[model samples]
Each structure stands twice: as structure tokens, then as C-alpha cells.
Target chain A: MKTIKKVALTALAAAGFGAVPGLFGLPGSLLAPGFAATPGSAMAQECGTITLGAALSLTGKYSTNGLHTKNGYEFAIRKIKEAGGVKVGGKCYNFKVIYYDDESTPARGAQLAERLINQDKVQYMLGPYSSGLTKAIAPVTEKYKIPMVEAEGASRSLFNKGYKYLFAVLSTSEQYLASAVTLAAEVAEKRQGKKPSDVRIALVVENDPFSLDIRAGVKEDAAKYGMKIVIDDRMPRDLSDVSATLTKVKALKPDVLIASGHSKGAATLTRQVGEMKIDVPMIAITHCESADIIGKFGKTAEGFLCSTQWAETLSYKDPLFGSAADFNREFKAAYDMYKNRSVPYQAAQAAAAIYVFKDAFERAGSLDKEKVRDALAATDLMTFYGPIKFSPAGNNIAKPMVLRQVQNGQYNVVAPSKFASHKLIWPRKVQ
Target chain B: MFGLCDFFAQTCGNLSILFAAPVFNVQLLIDGVLVGAVFALSAYGLALVWGVMNVKNLAQGDFVMVGGYLTWWLTQTFGVSPWVLLAGLVASFALLWGLGWLLYRLVIAKVIDRDLFTSLLATFGIAIVIAQVLNLIFGSDTQSVDPGYESLTLLGGAVTVAPQKLFAFLLAALLAAVVITFMKRSRMGQAIRATAQDPRAARVLGIDTDRVYAFTYSLNAAICGAAGALIVMIWVIQPFYGITYSIRAFVIVTAAGFGNLPGVIASGLGLGIFEQFGGFVLGAEFQQAIVVGVLVFVLLIRQIQQAMNRQVVQ
Candidate 1:
């Protein structure tokens, strides 16, 4: 009888320990104070705090961009505080974000989203780093009726799901590399004096939803120009090498090569292209700034065209962040790690997401989640990142994805004619 | 279902490409063989530990990552010369040897006499701890070191081989030869071999089996460390990338069977070539899937061989 009683007590103790995380969302709340208390103490004291929960990829594959996203959010919050916080319902509230490390996994992302909503009682959420992670957490936020202002997820499929509570400030993934294809066709028509249909494309993309959607976009655009896809390869997720596909590129001699993966994929592709001396006439890839290709690869990355959602040289401005170039300069001054490197679009759009939240909160004039979400849907504002206006589908529709070429170690916007800040370097020279 | 059809179409297209340009076969073969040389080093370490100590170490790849990180940090922090990077290889081996001894004293020594599952669980726990600690120290970015050597292009640049990869293959071979020589000629290696045959008999013959186990495990770690240092120079390493290496080691050892040195080398190279061909024909996405599929196939073949050896009695 005594043994049975002891067994029951032990079981109860074990169960209690297991339930602690679910009950309190221990890591999220424990990390919240340290992350939130860093901005402006005097302003925070004067204004009530509105807590926003974020489940970011703080420790896994996406951690590099995830850290950038986190830094962007924190930087924006600090700026907003210095600008006197968000005024809603005749009261000002400073933003305080509670962070949970999602470890770059979809399952963990969804679980953390639920914990943030149910356990921490957080009504507002900021998105995780990648489209894959955002897809995982969107259903949870939708189920809980919590509004999420996501900056990173650009997958077109994310919008087609008819999610009411999910809002994104970045352009969709399909638009990411479509401009590259269009540029390729334009080069063929103008320079080579050939039909657009004569252009050949080689695509090497990561197998994830984000890169695959980028692939689909490129394919759709390429088909519109009647261009042929010579080599279509899906790189593995943990991409270390893509030499085998590059070998095919050499044999086929495709006119243009478009590659998309996250930062790791970008780094690997850039490194191997240099080592192999792959001489494709034109090469365009995503996440070049995030990967720091110019800093890492130097001469090898000179002619590679990079697709970006935002560039510092753009003539975008707002009362809070001044100009797009101002945001770039001040952000670098605030974060030491970004010294000697350009601020990536991943970080820029993240700060823009926070600006969207502030705009919606001020316009709604209430603390209700549904009202803020409706305001987010109705948002039309120009910020340092870009002009963000959400379509009924909840994606920012006012912005266009720009193509930038690495000329003389600087990322200069060169495509789409209107956004061209520099001449497009045609037939990229081999190092 | 659409994915399956797409894969089939891709396979056919890739096969035709191979037939159309046979020069690519040379490129694939060269890449596979070079990568396999590095894979063999880690698998050889795993085989040594598994054969001598009867302990299945799931932390084999973590030891490699630790070595890679140490070399990368040294290169990045000190801006070391290529010659110093070579010295860093030896330094990593010695450091990892010490680490292996420390781990044996703390955890492995306790689990040595336990059941197989206990050793597996213990080593798995060690793997997680090592990965997490490395992540904390270095962050989760994928890092690699360039050896500053140019590549060799052949067949009108249709086939290119990085000089770093060739150097790594040669170094791996030299290391393997040295380890094989040491195992054959050294008294400690003889004791380890004897213990593997029969631990009780070796104990009766006045061999300190505990010390032999420690030395063997440490030597295995030292080999894996050297291999990892070479890998960082040629390829890339991340905190979470260790598991793929661990899986590759298991595949090589399982296919080769532990204690067979020649078999380990051959099977490692064979697996590498197979993966290259498979990834080339299918997409690079199938590279990991191919490793797992090989493991399952090898395991099934082993099960069948064991079943065949069993005699039914009436």
C-alpha cells in the first residue's frame, strides 16, 4: 500500500514537471523581459506596454536570417518608442515582444504560436523567418483569431489559403525571380538580336516551399516568353554543394541561370560557381545580401544579379524612419554585426512589418485583435522599407520586387527600367 | 502522384544526358571518389570503436564537427597561413584525442559494460549536448574555409576538380595507411584486436582491457577529428550538419561490416560514387534519401544472410 502511494506521488510530480512549459510558456516569458526592457525605459514607463509574441528560428537552419529579423523588429520598436510610442484609444502603448525560439522547424513553430496565444495570452504575433515556418504557424494564429504581421514569408500559396488573420508586408515569392526571367528575355531581344523564345534558362532551386515557389514563378514567366528550361534541379535543404548541377550548366550552356535557396544555398552556389569557373552568360540568385556574397566571395560575386524586395538607395521615406537610406544607415549604427555589410531585405521588410502594425494600431483606435486585423487589411502607408498596402488577400500589393547587380562591390538596382539606378551589366564577365 | 511522375521524367532526361555526354560520367565519378575518401575516414573511426569496445557511438559526427569548428575558429580568429592550417589539423587530432579520453572517463566508461541500447542512448545524449553547445558558441551559420588553391579544369571545362578536394583525398589515404600500420605493428593495437575476439580470454592473458578500450576510442576520435579538419577546408560545416555525417558513417560501417578495414574503404568509396550518380540522375534533393535507402537495403541484405545461416530443426 505504501509503495502504491509512493508511485502515485512520483507520477504526479513527473506530470507536473511536464506540464510546466505548457502552463506557463516558460522560455517565452523568461526571455521576454530581457528582450523587451532594452529600448527606452523612460518612454516605456510613461506609456502602457503592448506585448507582441514572436516564434523565431533562433537556433536552427534559418537562425542567420532569423536573427536579422529579430534585430529588425527590435530596432523598429526602439525607433517607435523614441518617436513617442503608438497612440491608440487616447492612450500610448510601447511595444514589447516576447520571443520563443522555434528552432527552424514547422512543428515547433506551430506549438510556440499556440503557446504564445493561449498560455502567454498574447493577442498579436510577428511571423517566423521563412515561408515554411510561417505556413506552419499561420493555421494556429488563424485558429486562435490572433493577428500576425509577418515580414519574411513570401510564398504565394500562403495568401491563397484564405487566411483572415495572417498579414504579410513582403511581396510574394513568385514575384521574386520573375523579374530575372523577364530581364533575361529583354537582354536576348535587345543585345543578341534574337527572339525571346531563343533564350534558355537553367534553374537550380532549393526543394523548400519558398524556393520552389520562386521556381514556379520563374517557370511561368519563362513560359510566357516561350523560353525553354534546359536544366531544372532541386538542391537539397542542407545545401553544401551543387557542382553536379553546375556541370550540367556547363554542358548545356544555358543563356541564363536562376538559383534560389536561402542564405546557405546562396553561399554554396556562389562558392562553387567561382571554384568551377561556371561561365553562364547571366546568373541571378536570391538572398545575395543576406549571404554577404560580396564580402565572402569578392571578385567571384561581381557580376551576379541579386533579387531584393528593398534596397537602401531607393527613394522611400516616412516620418518615423526618415528615408530608406536613413533606415539602412541607422540600422547599421545600431547593430555592430551588420557593420561593413549592406542591410539585407530580410531585415528591411521585418522592420516594415512593425511599421505596418503601428499604422494599423493607430488607425483602429482600439486594442481588439479583429479590429487591428481589419485595419491591417485596409492599410496603405509609405515607409522606409517601401509603400505597403495589403490586398484583400493580405499580402502587400503596392511594392515590386527589384533586381540588383553587384557592380564594383556594391548592390545597385539595375532592372525593371523605372527602378534602374544603374545600367544592367550584360553578359556577366567570368572571374 | 505528380511528384512520382516528375521524378520518372527527370530520371529519363538525366539518363539521356549521360549517354549523350559521357564526359559528365568522368566528372561524377571523380567527385564521388574524392568525397568518398573523406567519408571513409569517419567510417573507419566508427568501425574501430564499434569493433573494439562493442559500443555504438552516435556522437561520432559531433566529434567531427567539434574538430571542424576548432579549425574554423582558429583560421577565422588568427587569419592563419595555409601552413598553420595544416598544423591546425594535427592540433585538432590531439585536442579531440584528449576530449575523447575525457568523454570516456565521464560517460562512456560508465556505459561500456551496459546493454547496447544504453550505450546508444548515452551517445545520442552526448551528440545533442555537443551540437547544442557548438550552436551556442558559433551560432547556426554554415561555415567553410578556403585553402586558397585553384581548381583543375578538364574536358573543355566540362569537368572541374578543386585542388582542395584532391589534397583532402590524398591526405585521407595517407592517414588511413598510417592508422592501418599502427593497428598492425603496435602492441596496444594487438591487445585491442585480442579483446575484440574474446574479452575474457584477453583479460586472462594479462591485458588491461579497460585501458585498451579507452585508447581505441580516443584513437577513433583523433582520426575523425583530422577528417573533419580536412572537410572544413574543402566543404562546409554547420552545427546541425553533423547528423548527415553520422548517418553516412552508419551506412558505410553497416554495409562494410565492422572490423573489415579494406571493406570499409571500398564500401565508403562505393557509397560516395553511388550517391553522386543517384543525385545526378535524380535531383540533388535525393542525395540524403539515397543514403537512407542504401542503409535500408544493406540492413535487409544482412537480415536475409542471417536468416539463411539459421538451420531449422524438426
Candidate 2:
């Protein structure tokens, strides 16, 4: 045990000396005063359940993501059901969701959405787990003119595509990438105490559409900030070898490593970081906060940084968070699983999107799909994540985002001082 | 910056370094070669079985995965260091050997006199059954052994190699060489070879051909077990990933032609370099597509060679 400790100490020193960005260094320890006290949640008398449609991939490649979002949606439904329904404008309407697995295949998602609209006659639609699948079902939703809400497919241009009925819960892909650039600048200021523009960066992706969006977003914004993208190359999606990629990361010795992949593939990444002990810090843009990925590497993900939607350590009980604490508490009591690991932001986003549509329908005062579409287009309501103001087309959003840093396997907000519970954990130490 | 792929190429005029100069190119090669070695090791045992037992082992990869799951369990349960897990592997292999001998007596011997088509389908079914069983036991959570290398650097540029990976590469080469030499020189090796050449002749010469066949299969499985153990030290293992490894192994064996250890090593490394350079020119997203594409390309080449062989025979 003593020897293992000595070796671990020696290894960490050698890795730090290797002159790369440190491992996850953001302090996950600080506690947010949490959500402020809020008035009692509006309760409704059971007024019968109104069904919404979901064309989510329950199985196959995107199943893992779909499953998580489903948990979020279900947790929301459970909350509304427990409270007796949505208390809106003095009328209570129950929320019921109709879900189709879609199996992560594009064709199935399209067919499933069509079935939900026609056969099930669900008033609104929810859930499509991938960009391609979401795009496939977009036309279907538009045809019926039912208000569709999505947590997946953060493609910047999706909601931008002249659609009046589609609303998104999370930030657009471009917004997420912008957050990455933002983190890079903050890292340099806080850790390197140097100009953000001077920081060197490497761009690694899976050579897929999702990753491509990230790379393009970085390149487009990189020069604006004067940050040099020293390395830009993609490893294979099923990358079994990462030595060459890591080697280049070592040689270029960039200030940051940008990686994108599934949870399984991402596991090898942190382990490799521990092994070669490369100095450049890494930040994963998508699916990096996965419990499976982080759990495998443990402290190896310590100093790494990412722009995330939810962390278990957050004080969701704040007034700004609204019913997020209720959702979290209910989810834990029911499932015995923490929110961050099981109920990701997408799930909450999807469920809340449905509620927004329901409220829009109630406000519009009719099920005329087009009227609901107009109501969604004009919505300025507040939800768990804050205001739901959308642009004319409903793509570009005004949702507030908070930065998260990992410390000893926990995550805490490190940016946007109002929401920040802790100091920035930059260039985190592996130990 | 031009990136490290060219960092050394510019200074040393080493043309190969140019292939690895870009970070993307280097990463592609790293994934390919490290994975390629694993594929080679998995396929090596199959080649041995094909050569000695006169039976193509379609169920070979499934055995490799089964061995891997056992190792994963032992290490996870006992807190075994990866290096120390070799003993657990030996014990597991011994058990597998006993199972193999029993299988030979009850099933394989009954089908020994059957045609190729019959044997092939039967073993393929066996592969499906074994894979399903292992998948049930292990689940699909990508298991690996983290030795937590200090990530040493030897002054890298462009295609900078991780010392841990470099060490793994060296380890694969050394292991392959030792296993091949053992098979070539041992008395057991001669007996296995004798049985493969002519079972009737070997039996008449007092060799227990059945025992030889069963023993060779067990040793083949043991080699595969060792490969699995070493593989988790560097790569993550999943139940379904065995198919990719299996296909790559088959492709390398065909490219190198069976029974040539040096040729197999060359072919595996050659694919690794191709993938690395391919990422340089093509996109890395299709690297797996490229691997499968090259596999079909090699198959066509083999088909052409077979046609040429047939013409010569005529």
C-alpha cells in the first residue's frame, strides 16, 4: 500500500512535469448556498391525463442516451402526477407521455413519430435521441403542426430552420461549442494567468457529424479569440488505439485536449491519461459527464473540465431552480439513484418541454395544432432551467448555462458567479 | 503549427514520420496498431488450431472473450494486479483445456469424419452459443485493467508514441516470437505436426492423434487467454468487440497466409501503418470502414492467388 502510494505520487509528479494541462483541477468541493426558498408549488386537482408523443431510441446504438433522457422525462411525469397535474391559469391538466423506442435508427424514429401523431393522437410530441433521428422526425412533427420539444440533437441550425412548432430544451450545438471556447479562455486566465488568445488547443473528434459540428464551431470561434488550434485531427469512432493521438497531444503539448465519443470509448481515454500522464488537460464536449465513463477512470477524470447541464452536487433547491429540487428529491426517493448519474439534463429538458407545450396549448385555448405552434413561438414562460425565451424560429435560445468542474469525482459550478458554488478547478491534479 | 506528424519529419528527413506528423494521423495509427496486435494475437491461436487439428476453429474468438471475462472477474474480485493476473489466466486455461478434451471426446470426435461444410456450420453455432453465454455472465460494460502508467515521454514530435503503448507493442512482439518458437521446437509441437500431416500415419507410428488434437486446441486457447489478459492492460474489452477482433485476425492471417508468424506480424503492422496513413489522407471517422474495406480488398487478392494456384495445378 505504501509502495503504491509512493508510485502514485511519483507518477503524478512526472506527469505534471511533462508540461501539459493538469488533470481535472476544478474544485468540486465548494457548496452552493443552493436554491433559495420558494413559494409552495402549484397543485392541481386530477383533471384527466393528456398524452404526449415520444419517438426515442430505446435500444441499439443511441439507447444509452435515450434511456437517460427517458428517466428524466419519467421523473417529471411522476412529479406532475403526484401533484395531481399541471396547475396553469387555475385549470389542472394531467401530463401523460406516449413513448416509442425508435431503436436509435432514423427510419424507425420517423415512423414512430408518425404513429404517435396519427394512431395515438397525442396532443404534443417529445423525445428523439440523435440529430439524424430528430431531423428525420422534424418533418413529421411539422406536417401535423404539433408542438415538438427535443433534448437531443443540439445542432445549432435545427431550431434555426424556419420551424415555428419545434422547441429545444438544451443549448444548440454551436452554443455548447461556444461554451467550450469560453471554458478555454477561463482556464487560461485562472490557471495559466495568461492571455486566453495565446493558449494552444488541440481538436480531436470521432469523424462523425456530431463531432464535426464541434470542430467547425471551434474553428469559427477560435480565430475570433486569437486562440490557435495547433492540432486538428480525428481519431476513428471505434478507436481501439489512441497512442498516436496522445503522442501528438504530447508533442504539440497544447493547453487542452478536446475529445468526443461514447461512454465506453471514453473510458480508455482517462486511463490513457493516467498511463502516459500527458500534461495537456482534456475537456469533453459531449457525453463526458457520463457515470460509466467517469466511474471507470475515477480520479483520473479529476482535473478534466467540461461544460455540463447538471451535476449531483449542485444546490438544486435554489429558488431560481424552481421545482428542480422536487424532481431531484422525488427521483432519488423513487429510484434510489442520483440525478447526475441517472437523470441527465436532457431528460429534464424533454419533460419540461412537454409541460411548456401543454401550457402553450392551454393558453392558446385550443388543440388547433397551428395555434399551439404560434403559442410555442410566443412563449416567454419560466421552467426549472429558467426562462424559455426562443428566437422567432425557435432555434437560438436565451437559456442560461453554468460551467462545471470535476473535483474528486464530484462536480460543482465554477462559472457565472451568481450560480457558482465553488472556485474553478483548473488543470486538475491526477492525484 | 504544422503539428508533430511533421515535427520530426522536417528535422530528420525520415519520410515515415511524415505519416504521423498530424495529431489525427498519429491517433489513427495508434488506435489501429494497438488494436491490430490484439487482433493478431486472437487470430494466432486460430491459425494454430487450423494447422494442427485440421479443423478451422470458427469458435476461436468466443473462447478468447470467455477467457477475457474470467480474467476480468478474477482481477476485479481479488484485487489482482494486471501482471499477477497471469496465474489466474493459467488456471482458467487449464480448466478450458479440460473442457476442450471432454468436448473432443463427446462432440468433436463424432464430427471428425465429417466434411468441411458440416464442421464449419457446427463450430459457427458453437461460437454463437459461447458468445451469448459469456455476454450473459459479464454484461456489456467495457472492462479493462488500468496499470496507470506514469505516461512517460521519450521526446516525441508529430507521431509522438505513448511509452505505455510502445511498451505494449514491444510486449506483443516478444510474446508472439516466444509462442511461435515454442510451437516450432517442442516435442509436443512435433507430435501435433505429425498428426496434422497424416492422422493414420501418426497413429500407426504410436502417436495418440486424438490426444494431440485435444492438447493442441487447449494450448491454442491458452495463447488466446494470455492475449486477452495483456489486451485489457491497454484496451477496453466488450463482449461484441470480439467480432471486430475476429474479423481483423482473419484478414491478417489471410494477408500473411497461414502458419507464417513473421508474416502475420508484418501484416498486422502493415494494416496499422495503412490505417495511420489512411487517416492522413481520408477522414478518421471511416477508419473502421477502411479496415473492413481493406479486409475485402485482401480477400479479392487471395481469391486471385487461388485462381493462379488452380491454373498451375491443371
Candidate 3:
């Protein structure tokens, strides 16, 4: 009984010691009243630095892409500082990115976004990687009336919620597959003297919003082209096995196969398709541009078509990066120095997301959130990544989607003739 | 509620029509059985260890994942592909057996005689450690082995079967046969059974029960490793996928009951078939849902059966 009493007292003492920080930190700040900032006057002083905050998935399933997104944002900021800081209210303000690891969970992302705005007092926001995380953080930014310019997050449903402050630089998820359908239709017309309506397509998608949006887009475009959808199925969650889908694809033998999912889904389809030896006239997958797909699939990825937002070979130019080629060279050199590898297209798009903000801040010429948001909404400019123009729904619809085909284990832009680095190789060669 | 009712009605209607049209194709059934064979091999390991040592190893699936990574490392890094990956699979099994012995000595030994839940929680911790260590070593990526086996179509090209899955099925069956034969005819196997039945009596009979326990656990790990090698050859594997395999093993072993070798095989195959049909009829989103749903359904049925037989769960 004496020993139990002593143990209880020790436990109580430990609890009290742990609570001391919270108890003492609150009232100790009450003596400091000069730190309070007046409304609208916070931005009136001459600015030396503007902090853009984000909650990124630095560790988790999305960590690989999250790291790339981080590199993109950092590279963009560094390039801006090198060129000259943004001129706002007749004063130059350098950029500083303040990020918190969201760990790839939506709830955690939303919580961190709230912390960034409420506690860190950030006025502008960049989104986390993936459509799901962006959707999670969108409401937090909207509640605070802070404008978020995001490079990723392609789900069409994100813009349908009537949120006023969420702007995306990447094309909507629906547009991801719409261009593939168009290219297929053009190929059918040229090669077989066939109308677009005669093309039969087998579509497999992941159940996530981004993939679902791609499915909706493909279906809409197929309908517009009069193409027939042979089979439209969602790959199983956890993506354990796609054999059932592959078996069905073998039986149906559609003219074109469109499969979209995350990185693993891409690898699974590529392997099983090889195993089942299910060869269609053409194969287009949404995540073909990801390193996981290329790294895992390797030589087998030949002749596969991929939907992309930016290509290093495109003719787009920007004041900061000079030309698309120059941006690629510089970006690749910088990325290699930092991490000893080439930068992914996702990273390039992320940097472009930052460019949108720079353009907006310069046009607005003020640190006010409303002014900057209005300037962003009115944006119609070109960057090394691509054109920056937002629709009423806050999606970038002005820039056209590029279709890239893997030839000899290298990604080459093949569609939208103006951006074509190589001709489209129809009826992918299987050996 | 109305939407659910409507969905049920639609499903019933589709089922009736599908029944008439022969929606359950031969190809799908064959694929289910092949996949189920893999599940059975892994499940056997879990049952063996659980019955002999009373250790509910939650890291059972992680053993399979580690086994797969071992084979992948050999194939990818060393470029060794002799005898359709036979050499690599053997090496993986031997390495996993050593790992199992180490794990038992370090962690499993402490919880060997504990209550079921305590062992369950401890093994769960071990599972997390294994998964994270694997991810750190292999770098979170999906990997598979390519045997360049062209699929052959059968039954009028209605059913396409890959050579790799067939090889996996044969290997799994062979391993199960060897284990059954060994258990029925070996001295160590008899000692293990003796200890499982009555440890005190077995000790009195001069059997080293502790040795039997360690051997049983390591043998289970080796079996899981062999099954994982087959999986890598046929399907893709990632570090986080260990839990799903573990769950499948647990479900199969529990539903089959202790020491029911034939029942384990039957349940694993049934699960595979049920998942395929569920994925086909309901959609791919419900594949895993149907797997877990069947587990619950099986448990409820077993409970009712036990109650009728005048048995109460302790």
C-alpha cells in the first residue's frame, strides 16, 4: 500500500511537469502587447520577404512526388530571387516558402493548412501533391479567404464546389484523357479511313477522384467522337490484383486501352498486360510520365502514350527562364546539384505554379489577398511550363494537353502537331 | 436505406440473368484457383506456428513480403536467373528461416507463453518494424519478376492462362504435399504435435518443447518465404502489401480450424474464387470488401455451428 501511494505521487509529479510549458507559455505572452498588428496595416510597411506556406506529403506513400513538388517550388523561388524579387507596392520583396509535412493524409494536410494560416499568419498558399490532398486543404484556404495557387490536383470536382479562392495551374483531370481520345480518333481516320465513332475503347480507372475525373473526361470525349466504350472498370482498391481486369481485356480485345491510376496501378497494368499478352492497337495510361512507371516498366513501356502538362521540348518561353530548353537545362543542372538526378515533370509544373504567383503579385502590385486573387483570376500569360489562364471554375483550361509517346525508352511529345517532338507511332510495336 | 434496397434488387436481377448467361467463366475460375493456391501456402505457415506454439503471429504476411524482397534483390542486383528463379527462391527461404530464428530469439520468445491478445499485439509491433525496415532497404517501390512466359489460351480462347501462375500453383501444391508428408512421418513433427497437445506430458516424455516451439516458428517463416517467392514471380509486390497477405493468411487459417490441412487448402481456394466473382459481378472496388465480408460471414457461420454442438468459446 505504501509503494502504490508513492508510485501514484510520482506519476502525478510527471504529469504536472509535462503540463508546465502550456501553463506558463500562455500568460507570459500577455506582458508583450506591442506584437499585435493592426488590420490592413500589416502589409503597409516596406516588405523584405513574403512567406508562401504549404502542407506537403514529405513522408508516406506520396513522399516521392511530394519531394519532387518541394524541389519545384524551391527551384522556382531560387530562380526568382536570382532574376530579381517581386515588385509589390513599389518595393522588392523576396520569396520564402514555409512548408510542413502533411504525411500524405488529407485530415493532417487540412490541419497543417489551418496552422499555416492561423498561427504562421501566411496570406498565400501552395497546394500539397495529389488531388485528394489539395481537396483537403482547399476548404481551409477558402475559410481564411487566402488564395491557393496549386500545380497538382486535377479532379474536376475540386472546382465544382463553388470555392472562390482555389486556383489550379494544371489542367483538370478530365482533360487528361480527352486529348488521348482525340489523338486516337485522328489516328483511326488517317490510317484506316475510319470515323472516330468506330473506335472501340477499353477504359480501366482507379476509384480515386483524379482517376474518376479522367474516366468522366474520356467518356465525354468518346461520346463526342462517337467512339464506343467496350469496357469501363475501376481497378480494385489497395490495387492488390488487376488480373481480373486484364483477363476481361483479353476477351474483349478493344481497339484502344486507356488505363489510369496511381504509380503502382501503372506498373501493375504494364506487367499483367505483358503477362496476358493483351495487345491492343494503342495503350494510353495517365501515370506513364511518373518515374515509377518508367523505372519499373523500362523497355516494356515502349509505344505507350502518356498525357502530360509540360514537355521540355515545347516552344513555350518565359521572361525568367528564357526558353523551355533553357529552363530544362538549368532545372536539370540545379536538381542534379541538389539531389543528383533529373527533375520530374511534376516538379517542373510545381515551379510553374510559383511563376503564376509571381505574375499575379507583380500585376496586383500589392500584398492584399483580394487584389492578388483578382489579378490571378485575370491572368493570361505564358511561362516556360505552359500558358497560365484560369477558367471561371479556377481550372487552367486555356493551355492544351500534350500527348507523349515512349519511343526507344524515351518520352517524346507526339500530338498537338505544334508541340510534336516526334511523329505518333500508331499501333504500338510489341516484340 | 432505399438506395441499398434498390441496389440489392438490381443485383438479384443481374444475378438471375447472369446465371442464365454463364457469367462465371472457366478462365475466371481457373485464375481464382491459381491465386488461392498462393494464399493456401502462406496460410499453412500461420496455422503450423499457431497450432504448435500458440503464437498468433500478426507478422505472418510480412514474412512473405520479406521473402519476396530477398528474391528481388538477388534477381535485380546480381542478375541471376537460373532454373526459372529456383536458386533465388531457395536462397530466400534459407535467409527467411534465419530471420525467423532471430525474430523468435529477440521478440517471440518473450511472448511465447502469453495470452493470445498479448502475442497478437506484440506480433503486430513486429509487423510494423519489418514493413518499415523493408521500405528503408528497398525504397518504397513495386517490383516483380519477368519469366517471359507467353500466356496460352484454352477452351476456345475463352480462358487465357499464364505460365508463371501455373508454375506458382504447382510449387505451392508441392510444398504443401512435402509439409504434410513431413508432419505425418517425421520424429520432429510428432514431437511438435505432442507438445501442442500436452506440453507438460510431452516434457515428461523427454521431448524438448522449447526446441519444438523455435523450430515450428522458423519453419513457418520459411514456408511464408517460399510462398512469397512464387508471388513475386507472378504478381507485383510492395513493402506496404505485407498486411493484406497477413490478413488473408489469418482469415484462411482461422476459418479452416487448427490442424485441418485439407480444410485450409479448400478455404483458400474458395476465397480466391469468391473474390474473382465478387470483383466481376459487383466491380473491382469490392474485391477486398468481398474478401473481408466473406471472413465475417464464415466466422458467424462457425459460431452458429459451435453453438449447436454445445460448445462455448473461452
lDDT of each: 0.87, 0.66, 0.82
Model 3 C-alpha lDDT per residue in residues B212-264, reported as the tens digit of each score: 88888889999999988988888778777888788888889988887678888
Across A1-431, the per-residue lDDT of candidate 1 in tens digits comes to 99999999999997787678667867644533433213345743778788899999988767878999999999999999999999988888889899999988999999999988877788899999988899999999999888999998999999999999989999999999899999998899899999999999989999988899999999999999999998888987754567778877877789999999877788888888888888988999998876778877778899999999999998889999999999999999999988977787788888999999999999999888888988988999999888898888889889999999999998899987886999999899887
What DockQ values do the models have?
Answer: 0.41, 0.25, 0.35
Q: Candidates' TM-scores? A: 0.90, 0.74, 0.85
For model 2, state the Cα shift of residue B47 in Å. 3.7
* Candidate 3 segments whose C-alpha is farther than 4 A from its true place: A1-47, A291-295, A337-342, B1-26, B53-55, B112-117, B152-160, B198-211, B277-282, B289-308, B311-314
Error (Å) of candidate 2 at residue B165 is 5.7
Which candidate gets the maximum DockQ versus the true structure?
1
Task: Name the lDDT value of residue A98 in candidate 1.
Answer: 92
True contacts kept of 1: 0.45
Instruction: Give the lowest summed-lDDT range of ten residues in model 3 chain A.
Output: A31-40
Report clash pairs, candidate 1. none
- Model 3 whole-model lDDT (C-alpha atoms): 0.82
The candidates, ranked best first by TM-score, are: 1, 3, 2
